[model samples]
Target: MALSPEDKEEYDEQRFAWIGADTVLATKDSDQIDKHLRIIQARVRTKSATAHRAFAISGRAGLGKSTTALTLGKKHERQRRKLLGDGPEVTPVVYAVVPPGATPKMLMRAFATWLDMQVPQRLDAPSITDQVVRVLAQQKTTLVILDEVHNLRTTRSAGAEAASQLKVFTERVDAAFVYCGIDLLTSDLFTGDIGKQVRARTKMYALEPYALGSARDREEWLELVLGMEDLLPLANHPEGSLEDEAAYLYHRTGGSIGSLRGLLGDAAIEAILTGKERVDRALMDDIILDEEAVRHAQESTAPSPTHSRAKKTG
Candidate 1:
């Protein structure tokens, strides 16, 4: 059955949004997310006065650390509400991004804004911290997930200040924190006095890129590709094509799930805009740097090492 023009246009728009920066898709990394969720829930469930320990999700740009943390926050929010049942709406998890080059004051303001509360003008960092803490308590927040935590590494003093603020939060609030960013454990944010305190308390979890070195890794990578295939709104199915292009896709993306998604997403967009019906090798050729083309170019152009060696011998 043919889709009406209106329906087709809407479907295409929805497909585009599927791969947008804000949209979170569950990948193989979701298993790790499940573990984090369980940890946070345990922290919430435990009644002991034992000091709370935080955890981090660390990875390079494109490993979906931010998405995973944000998604976990949302999931926690829903679970919190459901558990409350007849109780008033309580936000269990608060998600915030550490602004680039943000100071303690700026970080407080960001937190205030994320909570939908106004930051009073001309307030000191201590006052802002108090207000933010009160609000989180009022909202019954159990966890705080800070994304782009590496931004705290702007400088030694800045990193220390940020780490101190976080440490204070852990000391003052009942909430456990989750920090997500790149190489945060090795950053200045984990170095120095206050940083050392935070590093001592928070467990580190690393999210590595998908590897194609083993059969298990390859299967996981292919599962990711198939998951993305289910998102594309192409008239002709593109499921098998991704499996067929597995080697090339892995090579182009270096097994980074984000890069793989971007390559396939951009190709899907091109296919939609050009009315191509579906993604194919030829379509991907135009969108991604074709590996075959690169191989042919390299094979054709360079002076032969064998010939050079023969000439040298002669």
Candidate 2:
């Protein structure tokens, strides 16, 4: 539906709220995260100080892997409420995103900050390890989500070193470790001997994109799709053309939840500019018109990227 004036105003406010939204939105899509979070909740209630489980949230680009991991961490925090009576308590869920070129020391610094520990700007790996261990025990962290942990494997000069460090860390740390990444992480971290050693301690998961095999579910699913018609800024298309366009949309977007919304949004803008009755195929083609269009427009828009320098970089 075309957004009414009031709708537009509401949309603007909600969009503004999401401008710097770092927390997760509770949704069925995040159930995998919830499952682990609930596990932590149960573990917390039991008072067993066993080593935490490793949570793996694997998915393709734009599939909300990091968001889901952060959501799990957030949910784990909610579950910590009843634990207030168990000595000095604090937020149980500690979330961190592992950027490329991050080492154990860097990881420690980031974790320390999240856990609210008095950590210095720089520390050796052993020292950071000591501090993190002490902090986790003290704060009673229920879960530690390390998003984009695939980058950790890329941090070391030698692949074996990276793999070994992860293994050693998991073996030594008692907190639940969550590793979120795309498909390659399993191969990168699970192939060699060290992988076999550490694989059992760590679990893996994938966040698959939304797909509709046919038009049967298209209309119903459209409401849930990320960049679909309701959110698009399209002028009214006369009569029955919108549904036809929606079908074309399914074909073009391969039913991807993220892509379909963007596809419609771009088409809507074109429709408004051209004063067209409906958002048709030709307008969709104009969005990028080719592979480079997608490469440039689609990817540069992600909320999180390993690196982004709008200006020229050497």
Candidate 3:
């Protein structure tokens, strides 16, 4: 049965919203993050003043670092609201993205903006930082997730000051800090004295792309594919259809959850618009992924010396 033009428009809008609201996949990395978050929340509940330990999630782009952290932060906020009720004063989690070339003032402004506080341009960095700290403490913020923390470099004067300000916030705010960034272990954000302090205070968790080398890896990837597939709003989409093409999906996305979400989300939208109402190899082939994912896919498929040797031996 063919739909009317108005119906098609409504369906398209619905599909767009569905795709844009990316589903959170419960992969091992997210589970580990959640476990750490729970421990942090527990410490906060117990009023552990000296337990200023932070959790750091670092990896390559499109590996779901920000999503995992933000999702867990929202979950923590919800749990907090459940206990204390939803009050403006009871902000359990405060999330802010560290802007590129972030100064100490800019970093504090990010927090201030998230908290909907107006900061005067004349205020100095220390003043702004003090205000942010006071507000965060007043709001009773327990978890502070700083995304794109790779931007807070310690090499530059402004960045170093920003890093120092961040440490001060941790010390003063009495909250569990979670930092998310790309390739932070190798990044110079943690160099010299400030780096040593960050390293000592924070526990690092590396979220790597899914690998398809082992049976366990394959199972995990397939499970993620199935989970995402189940969320598609397409009427004619078959069950386990994406699971069947799980290998191809992994090849295209390099097993990055973010990349996988983008690819599937776009493909699903295309399917709805074109009246196919299903995601398949043909539909997905028409979609282009991010440069990083594309490059990773190309490298994964490219024959290597080890692969050539194994093939020859076999």
Candidate 1, residue 84: lDDT:
67
In model 3, which range of ten residues has the least summed lDDT? 305-314
Best candidate (score: TM-score): 3
Worst 10 residues of 2 by lDDT: 19-28
Q: Tell me model 3's lDDT, rounded to 2 decimals.
A: 0.84
Model 1 lowest lDDT segment of ten: 305-314
Q: Report lDDT (Cα) of residue 213, candidate 2.
A: 60
Tens digits of per-residue lDDT for model 2 on 52-132? 456677766655676666766665566675655444556576777665676666666777777777766666766877877
Error of 2 at 286 (Å): 7.9
**Candidate 3 per-residue C-alpha lDDT over 1-314 given as tens digits, one digit per residue, 9 for 90 to 100:** 57798987886897799789846556757777888777865675665556377889998998888778877877788888999889788889888999999998899899999999989999988898888889987888888989999998788898998998888777777778899998887765766888987888778899888998999999989988898888888989989887779989898888999999999899998888887999998889889899888888877767686665322110
How many collisions between residues are there in candidate 2? 4
TM-score of each: 0.81, 0.63, 0.89
Ranking by lDDT: 3, 1, 2
For candidate 2, what is the lDDT? 0.58
Query: Which stretches of model 2 miss by more than 4 angstroms?
Result: 1-17, 26-29, 36-52, 82-89, 116-118, 154-163, 171-174, 214-220, 226-314
Comparison by lDDT, 1 against 2, better one:
1
TM-score of 2: 0.63
Candidate 3 wrongly placed segments (more than 4 Å): 1-11, 44-51, 305-314
